[model samples]
Target: MTTLAVPAARFHPLRDSATMLRRNLRRMVRYPSMTLMLVAMPVVFLLLFVYVFGGTLGAGIGGSAAGRAEYANYVAPAIILMTVTATVQGTAISIAMDLTEGIIARFRTMHIARVSVLTGHVVGSVLQAVFSLAIVIGFAVLVGFRPTAGLGGWLAASGFLVVVTFALVWLAVALGQVSKTVETASNLPMPLMMLPFLGSGFVPTDSMPTVLRWFAEYQPFTPIIETLRGLLTDRPLGNEPWIALGWCAVIALGGYLWSRKLFAREDDR
Candidate 1:
């Protein structure tokens, strides 16, 4: 009995996590409108920036002849990052739903691994983010955004984006857990969506006023956007990659610890 129980305990977490992930995926399908809303914001922003603002922005960065096509290339990476942020915002909403609906309490009474609940949300969110990113990138391409990345560059950028997504999803989970209501949870991550704009996203940081430029240069999202931009453009990446990784590591660790504590506290109630 002891031997059997030992292996069962060790393997249950993986099995439970897979089960939870399927549950989340099914929920995602059942509520297609939510996914569409999340994806639409980024696509809208991409269009608005590339078509309406692109010509002027492009000319400012390059020359007048650079036009919308050039601006598309410059802004594509930021839009991709925004897609990630937007998808994770859904994670917070889902987590809030599970918590407030007493589902989490019911799960606590079950024999399944506890952490699998959160893991399921994280995994499902990461998958959704990737899918949304593909759609956004395809749209960007349709609008004249061309990347010079080779196979190696594309692979590296993909890996980096996955890491960034993982970090943000975990953070969203923590935020969702702390929210008193679903509305609050959804609002908590709204600032994340604005980070790109406040950073070197739409325009160069050097082009901003002195104080704003300083803030933009030092912010976490700026380094991340810059690193992703460099990888996608096949440009020379100096230390931005390292700084971005460091920020992700800190956010991931902090979020993980906070989430575990919150979950445990709720269990004790």
Candidate 2:
């Protein structure tokens, strides 16, 4: 008697990831209160800075209506950056919640691709970040933030935002994996949220003291913020875009590798 050969089922990580992503996206739609809160926080920051502190900050930048306009223009980029950082907090918490709630264990036992689970979170978070950025920028425009850049500039600015969002989301993923609880995950990325303030996001680097000025000039967020400002306002980019791209590369790679290692460790546990 002749034996027949059997064909094994093919595994498609991308297809699996897309399916998982749809599940997460559906969850986001079903529970939008968190998204609303995340979106609102950036708008509040925009209002607080432009109205509450705009007078003093505007005068510092210049001295007339032009000064106010200048301040609005300068701060818009920072607030957009803040929007991205703020939205990623939910990503971390959601991932941590899943892990702690045994969702990952359930996924592991299923006959699906493993990496797809994390990929779903990353994609969902990045999309959320972009939505938050758009809302914050719209609020900024209403408050007198104007960009002098044309189509090319807008495109470049968008590209930079996408890059930074991806980098930050990856980092958030790693943070989520390391945290033992959702609360801890929510707080772990606080420093990432605060980095803009410590950098030249609100003021000129020269305005800061020596040590802070140095740090403000060199920190990862500064270059990214400056690149964004330059793209939006027709200012000289200098080397900021390159530096910001380098930082994005480093963050994305490090976060991806670390998250994968931690995720793999789940099996060992």
Taken over the whole model, the C-alpha lDDT of each candidate is: 0.94, 0.90
- Residue by residue across 156-193, what tens digits does model 1's lDDT show? 99999999999999999999999999999999999999
Per-residue CA lDDT of model 2 for 66-106, tens digit only, reads 45667888889989998888878888999999999998999
- Which candidate tops TM-score? 2
Error of 1 at 67 (Å): 1.1
The CA lDDT at 125 in model 2 is: 88
Which candidate achieves the best lDDT against the true structure?
Answer: 1
**Per-prediction TM-score, please?**
0.96, 0.97
Report clash pairs, candidate 2: none
Candidate 1 clashing pairs, residues 3+ apart or interchain: none
